[model samples]
Target: MQHLSRRQFAKAAFWLPTLALAGPAWAQTGDDPVEFVESQYNNIYIYKRGTQVSMTFGHNKRLYTESVMDTTDTKALPVEYTKFMTAAVAYTKKQDSILQIGLGGGRTSWYLHVHLPDAAIDVAEIDPVVIDLAKKYFAVKEEKNFAPVAMDGRLFLLRNPAKRYDLICIDAYRGPFVPFHLLTKEFYVKVAEHLTEGGIVAQNVEPSTMVFNAAVATMKSVFRQVDFFPAAGNVVLVAYNDAERLSDAELLKRAEALQAKYAFRYPLTDLVKGRREPSNPVKGQILTDDFAPVETLHAIERKNEKWK
Candidate 1:
């Protein structure tokens, strides 16, 4: 796992929804009236006139409800996402089961449903409002292959211990940032507990941000082998508990095969590069509930460009 700045990551992830909820300070702006809606205990401010959503940070940054559907954007489905999916597809043929932890605008969920028709997808989202908004505004459709589970991902995974998935995607984020509990060693181990043999966990980690280093450290503690794919200022961590190594040559060959099959834009070029020489090659620290301090690691990444 690596860390990246929120601003840099935001730029890289142009398709991700910007979080700028409305607050009392926004009410002071009398002329531009903003409607506020609370979802999952978070305040979401919608501009009464247009598609822009306001931020509570006092800086009025607006994001369109339509951009959420554009999975091609680096933020939504970063190049790393396509690469990880390619690898997962290669590894598990014949429409294996795929589980996604988060469903923001249903970008990855819809893409997987459309592309991997044979694969069964289970999407767990904490906020139904986001899911509903994605459907109303982002044009996210649900089909037989897609199962939307409105529940906390951690609790769901724990409850369904028998459920094993071939590919698991963890993209849970909290208002422009990843929640600290979700990035801990304990949580990752729980993720491992629900995985099938040879299954890979693809985690969307913002390395430049505060949560990046702790996430990497936590992931390392659970999986026997972990690899990174950097794209759009974010790192997608693919962890394998069963195998220590996945041959680079094999991975490249498979990537090429997938590109021909799917015609993906980013495909597997950069993923292959990361495999050769990773940014954080050695294990740094284990991220436990009490001991993890991801913010500090994020600060170090900001100072040292070598992590990239």
Candidate 2:
């Protein structure tokens, strides 16, 4: 057996439990079929088990599931975090235009596209391979209103100065960690610049990471109201420039209205109930492009954990 370093061990420990929790029913069977496997920006693996298809990226034992979809029922969002991400709709009454930083299996985008047929959806996926896989296996299709561009999210935002969105979702992840550039305060400023009035940004953040507090702090520095929806092993952050924070009653009312209109597979009302108070006096420093040490923070967090 190859000797694993402490970091490797910690990463394995972190992912193993999540795999057990988030993985499809076939995960325990050990008979899942590999639909595709390739190496590019990351080692990518696609698995198909029954009606479920999943995309995972990583090297060796450090694998992380990026996206999962139920092929038989596209609206049935299998991942808990994706369901939480849909809660972003409650924050904005008009989703005329939406910008999603990462495509993943295109589950979230597809769900939104189905429910908000009038909305124009733009997806930025840095990896063309993932986009191709999403179309080939995940039932993702590009139509007149839906556009998936092959480009880095930050570059896409930088290049399109005039484009604004009613909602912006930052679910980009390289394995379990967000890209360093995407986590910085500067990157968030660019994200905020692209939002239309009353627009909101929803991000999927892994709270287990040491940079979690810093990520929240960075968003607080840029946006006036930051709300949290904690899901299994992840937290979905809803941040906007509103002067007054929406009360639970208000959010619940919006959620009820959305639910009545769309009747989403995952109830928006249940997701809204997951919302909790933000951490007061967030502990970490605001992450700037010049000083965001995300990898270092992850290492420190792992080092502090008591490994059995």
Candidate 3:
């Protein structure tokens, strides 16, 4: 196994203990926060604020929130598009089953389980620590209909040939970068393979990234139709397996139906209103497993060239 030098190792070990004194650290006085961190991926920070319990992944000088739950009620989704993700139920012809990638705090999966009790909700998570946090702190129950498996999202899809889903939600982010492998056309082809006829995929995308267009293009290569729904700063891409486009008028009708039946805390109509096609569908190069430049593109996006 590769080993970190004492100096390098200490950097990862440092400041974690100091934060506990900072407040609501996910550990007791004798416990260590370093235990929650995964190798070379993220330094996990778990904390609680009043009725909210949250998890953050710190990497590349940015602390991205992994998940947050309302301690008072797990059914109430704290994130905006998690409610929007339910919009998939509107677009898809069936709501029999779902495959959600990236368990995080397990709020999305939990919400799906509660709202669509009849649907089989399967969640594939890459990190055991994330799963533990969800169950222990976030109140995600494991029942017959709700299955939480510890596996990479892509591998989970590849391995489960017999299993198919009406909707597949992909929002797997690793540290500062969305996993390059997950953003590729080839991976989405696998995602398309796991879908039932008339199935749709709901993916949480970082529109701020320079590679956003490329990411959409990659998805479009596999799925016949792709639509974008604005969510705060991010966008959720709903890709349909069949070659058909849905107009805003059409989506609004569907959204209204879901909102009336479910009465989501955040009305599903906003997601419908936020709908639009890719501004530059062919702008960025299509990402592929063998030739993805996600990190490079992100770095370019971060670099402010306005001054130059």
Largest TM-score belongs to which candidate?
2
Give TM-scores for every candidate, taking all chains together and pairing residue i with residue i: 0.73, 0.87, 0.82
Superposed Cα deviation of residue 23, candidate 2 (Å): 14
Whole-model Cα lDDT per candidate? 0.60, 0.80, 0.72
Better of 1 and 3 by lDDT: 3
lDDT of 2: 0.80
Tens-place lDDT per residue, model 3, 144-253, is 88999989998998899889999899889875567888889889988888999888899877665577777878887888887777655566788996556887788788
Error of 3 at 251 (Å): 2.1
| Candidate 3 to truth, TM | 0.82
Q: After superposition, how far is residue 250 of candidate 1 from its true place, in Å?
A: 0.6
Give the clash count for each candidate. Answer: 13, 0, 0
Q: Which pairs, if any, clash in model 2?
A: none
For candidate 1, write residues 163-252 as lDDT tens digits. Answer: 888888888766455666777888888888877777778887666543565576678778877776665455667788755477777777
> How far off is model 2, as Cα RMSD?
5.2
Which residue window of length 10 is worst by lDDT in model 2?
1-10
TM-score of 2: 0.87
